[model samples]
Target chain A: MALEAEVWSDIKPIPLDDGPDPLAPIAYDAEYSEAMGYFRAISQRDERSERALKLTERIVEYNPAHYTIWHYRQQILFSLNKNLNEELDFVKEQIESNPKNYQLWHHRQVLVEKLMDASCELPFINEILNDDAKNYHAWTYRQWIIRTFNLWENELDFVNKLLDKDVRNNSAWNQRYFTLFFNPTKPTEEFLTQEIEYVIEKIKMAPNNISPWNYIKGIIAKSNKDIGILEELCKEIEKQDIISPHAIGCLVDIYESRARKGSATDKEEGIRICTLLAEKHDAIRKKYWEYRKVILTSL
Target chain B: MPTEKEFVRDKHISYLKRGLTLLPKQYASNDTNRMTLAFFCLSGLDLLGALESEIPEERRKTWIDWIYAQQILPDERNPEINEKICGFRGSPFSGLPFDPNGSRESRLPFDAANLAMTYTALTSLLILGDDLSRVNRSSIINSLKYLQKDDGSFTQTYQGMESDMRFLYCAVVISYILNDFSGINIEKAIDYIKNSQSYDFGIGQGPGEESHGGSTYCAISSLYMLNKLDEGLLSKEKTLFWLISRQESGFQGRANKPPDTCYSFWIGASLKILDKLELINYEQNHNFLMQTQAKFGGFAKLIDNYPDVMHTYLGIAGLSLMNEPRFLELDPAINISKKAKENLLNNCAFHKQK
Candidate 1:
């Protein structure tokens, strides 16, 4: 992928120096080394020409994780006043190949910010999420786009769709919270109650799923509501013979909070749940449950 | 039924030695991060107690020289222009000429230092038993000021890289090793770390990001190095509970995520740093790590997954934290052998003053 020999004839490529003794030297492909050598020379000269842009594209194709090359490519795109729409298209292709690359996401952000248009971001990120629901970079970038462009109106619906598809999608649950609470208006008491109800329904669908449980806890904490609200629901679930570890874990937290607030009855309840978790339900974290029991007993 | 496996000490040593000599073609994309790769091998060997017996003294000296060569020393002519760019590049990928003696006249335009690379390079030098007399401490400290964003998070470099909890950890580690806090705005940084605490009570890469074991380690370790672990966390008990809950036979980066071998160190080391290492179910954790141990030489991310250098190092470090007698003791906060940390304390000039 090195530049045509005659195109950069005037420049001498700068070879990489690995000092006297290089450790763990990667046997790079010949194409990569040649392109990098010329790239080093072009970058040294601070070139912002079309040739430099082409060189960057070649290097980026080889390694999309190169932040320096992406930075330089952005500068070239700006200095040359190249068609940014075309650049966006190029970035879209790169992102499709390297969905987890932070550099590609950052490059896309720079391009979108400069274009002053976030219209294409949501659908594009949705497509990426459809492939891998928990792509962290895609979710974070989607959040940034939403916050920056005031695209919060449909975010909850998008999160709902994702949750309907996969109830265990923690990223989607986090987004639901972000869309509701991180927006401009503060969440009202009615809205908090509705969110708690929504999470409780999701929890009933899958009692062991921790995402909804965490979501309900977050909603309660945000409203400064008491954890006691979930006590009756836990008891009802247990009455139905559903022995969910997450439900029990939540009960332990609820009781632990009340116990710490000087409720002796809640302390005993917390110790009982901790024992149940240690002996029967969740033996994997037996030590953690035992530790919880010790704290409760001490209280 | 699965049979428990013994720690493959010899195989791991061979795996690390192979990485130190020549990496496979798949690592070509990691050419820019050669320093980090080298750190994984050298530090892994150090933890395995093979540094003295496996690598000769002369070879170690050469490595020390090579790491010193990566240092981005300030341009004496225009110190102000080069001030914020002083630290270590990951490699000579920027095409700087070989200058093991560091007598270069001018700094190149693209030869900027990265915070992660600087942290790894400094630790590598220490692991190789160098005195670090040649490190440009002031320049690096000055660069940290530039790297820190207004939000108190740090970018990897001054050239506008992605800022996150990982880079924040690197910045803190660099300052901790240099024995200077002037470069960091402690209050703002602590605020940033505090804000990164997710509702699950685990720390994330940034505010509103999902709680992850790796970022949790970085965030907690940064707070520990800053002398604010107890005060900095939103809720110590909840955070510890979240961390302990990650151990579903083995550790997962996040809830509902499949168990990965590396989180054994990420979460396990975080627990160790919090002085709650004993809380982990050691036998279960050991059994999980045994499942991930590759038959050849390294540990994989999951059972039957391919072995790689990073996981190999972390898996062994996780065992070391559990007080596994076969491996050297690790300083969980720094992710290096306790012996190497002792070397830093006794010999490095920064500690000499203390």
Candidate 2:
């Protein structure tokens, strides 16, 4: 009689999966009773620690595409917090199963970031960027982390990597230029010269972006003590966007800085270059006068 | 180039109106708030040339009565600050019986002179063509006296928040508009403003805060009002140069913020106040303002955006400064009615002996 009762208790009102018809597929009322009994048994058992996970897994088997159940299963595992490696594995599996889901991808990233810990965070972010070259979120997150850590070398490397993928990425290009301006470490002339050359190469490919032109002007103004790169960048800028006030102002700045530094050759060249640019670019005339005022007063 | 006077007037009138709303009677702040909003909105209308036939006399009288009711008496019993002057509160939140004295049995912490409210209150009275004969002048001065700090900055209320150049400028404008300097310590306030100027020549909110366009205008405008527009505080040339440098086709408030609708009145007005607005490219700034105008006849935060009242007014003010065709003429100083300003001047001369 006990064996018969146990068999009756096991009979679910709703089919769990494809097993046997089992008495013409128990009625919905009986199915509800059996599900309730199963839930009660799991709750009563002291060692059924993974019971929720199992339930979620079974539900997924019936509906493989149920993201909600998959979410619940992940949450239960995470809340238990007993097994991090297992948690990571599960996240990775979800990503593998649903690679197109940006949310899942972000969750995988969070797990990866956690697993790497603080000391290895930057390198891990770079590794992810290396895998997916067009990951804007990853790139931005890496930049933010680098900023907090003040990791100048890592930031420069990140800029180089981004440029290698697409030099015309305006945000990346702008960041590269801003790094020169805002970096805690002062840039040496040699470093800036090399940077100007690299950007010039990119500008050759895409001439419409006014950012590189503006940056080249800043470099010339700051380092007009060395006339070589400044002269080249100035000539290149004149051909690109002569109407950009920022570009023209930079020309004025270079001339004024050179005159102040007593670089006679650069000063003469600066005035001539600025005058020519100012003639063509009406917007920058005020900047020319400002620079002229400074130079005249200094003289 | 749009004149700074035109820019400030148009923008001030326009944005001031945009910020106004006739809250349904159920949502209305109270009789006092109704007065305050009336002052702001009506004053805004008066400045905007849209005031005729709309402001009813009885409604104006009610606002005046409610505003006058917020005045405090000068006596030692009420140890609370701002106890002796007439100023406006933001709203009647505590529902405590309206005490003009700012001292009542159940008065909450909110009972005091709010800087924005006081400015609006005085201006509104003037806009209604009131001679300000009923304003408790002595108590108002005493209230302002308590509102100022040793650092020369004023708080919005006696209950302090951040001490700022904005409030200090407001105090100066209030004093200037009222033709009364009995309330503020001019030297300390000027010193605070001078200290707040960043290396970039733009004024910040306070020491160590980032330079902003709005504060820059406030500092300069206040200095002009105080008759302290000399080389001793902010060198005229350097401040003007900084003001001129803010124009990047459209005006921006700080080092890196993209140009927006508001800064044109701010920096643009400062340059105008300094008589140096001609240094900027008027056509470009005007073009930028015109482009940002909304399709529905309002202005937005930026070009190709939805229009709101604040930006709409600011955009119009910016254009007005340039003396844009079809825009009304404006007073560069104080940015109120040239008609009202003339009236104010006439009143001042009438009372010159005092």
Candidate 3:
């Protein structure tokens, strides 16, 4: 269209003297000016037009991190009813270019949820996760896809694959908790028991790793009822955890909970451990530990 | 990585100076978020001591007028009806007309002020030496009543948007700058920040989400601004542990995440607020930040990443936290240079002067 040509008219190569870069022989003054002009033109153009849709493709390719453009891209997609699978593939290419760009993942979500089924998304998400196990944006979008598709059965296996690769991947641990809380059908007592055992085993493998410790706390919070298994595990780990007091932290929490119920048998023992943790491992927060110790002693 | 561990001050100044004009590439994508970039460039220039010499006070006045010209205030007489749409929109790209002395009747259907934009707009004005006498303080505060959810977190506007740590920070800063927390339920905002703490102790955008550097900064900075830093943080030791451990040479936003440039500000500034900034490895942090500086000008989010105005400002702000000589002293809690902070408190209170 003549519009694209008109948009590119004032564009000239940026002289090194005028531009920010001296190392680059290739100047982007022309491309950037044209892109901005096209963007402005598209903003003023009819949203449902093929011209606006084409301009978005160019703009997005040039700057995938732009959230506002991506929002407009969504409007174009909805207005044009672009081919669903083709749109997914287009976004997939962009995702490969900048896996960390939140806007790209957001666009992918809008596309998949609006036009396509998410059953095919898990594998693609897995590929991205394998490259960067802690790609927070991918992890978040993956959870969204799972919830949208009701792919709960595939989730445990997915988490297992991730956890097997890195026990310290907090993103994966967070995902496990997400799957559990949103499991739709309440997780049976037997399932939770197994999950608690799973976390305990992980803690035994790396008692110091913080993610599993958090998962333990998450499961406990969701249970809404005290579990004897977690209590027994906390006691056992408390004796074994020497360099750090993660296990002791768990026991201190449980003991305080029991004290709140007026059934605290280990109040004195809990005080002893808080004293040690405060004195030793987590000295950075010694003031906090000291406070906890005082409260436990008073109880 | 660049072998020389230099801040590339001159290149960055030129990069920031060019910010008043059309940016090089891809930044046009941020055409709508221009105010945020405006804050970064102006403040970045201010930090470099180039603000007055390069961008004169007269030019700054125009920029200030441009910012105020974007305000969408109440109709004054129709405060109840017009209050719902108060706050700054990110840019004038909404096809809204620009008027130097804000026109209340300029309100259109989608014309609303964004919390993020309102935030940057105020900071930019103060940085450029504008006394905020023109700001519609009550209307903006009135709008916050609707924008804040029962959960205490705030969406960017009244109509509806995602309420999270980002907006919460913006809202708190807006109130702080206005010197009034009356519009917010400070207790609820405190509760939201407390609840957003992930089990591992770092703060997230919402409850039960993965802790991130950006959100952690937002949550911590908000609490500091609110003066609830002590009570709002759930587990100080765990939070400190998580924040401190984020640094490996440079800092990562989350666990198992690769180190990036901007986290130096997000995580670095968080540490500054917590009084643990000295614990960071300076040589490592400095070299890592130096690597992200492009050969020409500005800083990028990562090594080999395209330089942008936001990261450039943050990278400079982050280094300024370390008492980097080339940059001005930063008051990390407020995210401005000490000079700008002084100017904000001194000159902008012209209402008090009269």
The prediction achieving the highest DockQ against the true structure is 1
Write model 1 residue lDDT over A1-299, tens digit each, in one string: 44698988998988888866688888777777888898899888789998999888888777777888888888899999999999989999988988998889999999999999998889999889999999999988998898899998888898899999999998888888788878997778888888889889999999988888887888888789998899888888898899899889989989999999999999999999899999999988888899899999999
* Model 3: colliding residue pairs: B87-B113, B88-B113, B88-B114, B89-B113, B89-B114
- What order do candidates take by DockQ, descending? 1, 3, 2
User: Per-residue lDDT tens digits of candidate 1, residues B147-192?
Assistant: 9999999999888977999999999999998889899999999999
Q: Candidate 1: what lDDT?
A: 0.88
Better of 2 and 3 by DockQ: 3
RMSD for each model, in Å, please?
1.4, 17.4, 6.5
Off by over 4 Å in 3: A1-132, A144-153, A181-210, A213-299, B1-6, B20-22, B75-85, B102-112, B149-152, B157-162, B182-188, B291-297, B303-307, B325-327, B349-354
For candidate 2, write residues A46-134 as lDDT tens digits: 22246556654444333333333344445566666646566556655554454344334444444544465445556555666566543
Q: What's each prediction's clash count?
A: 0, 23, 5
| Candidates ranked, most accurate by TM-score first | 1, 3, 2
TM per candidate comes to 0.98, 0.56, 0.75
Candidate achieving higher lDDT, 2 or 3: 3
After the best TM-score superposition of candidate 1, give how far the Cα of residue B337 lies from its true spot, in angstroms: 0.8
Residue B50's lDDT in candidate 2:
66
Q: Per model, how much of the real contact set is kept?
A: 0.69, 0.00, 0.14
Q: After superposition, how far is residue A227 of candidate 2 from its true place, in Å?
A: 16
True contacts kept of 1: 0.69
**How far out, in Å, is residue B2 in model 1?**
2.7
> What's the true lDDT of residue B274 in model 2?
75
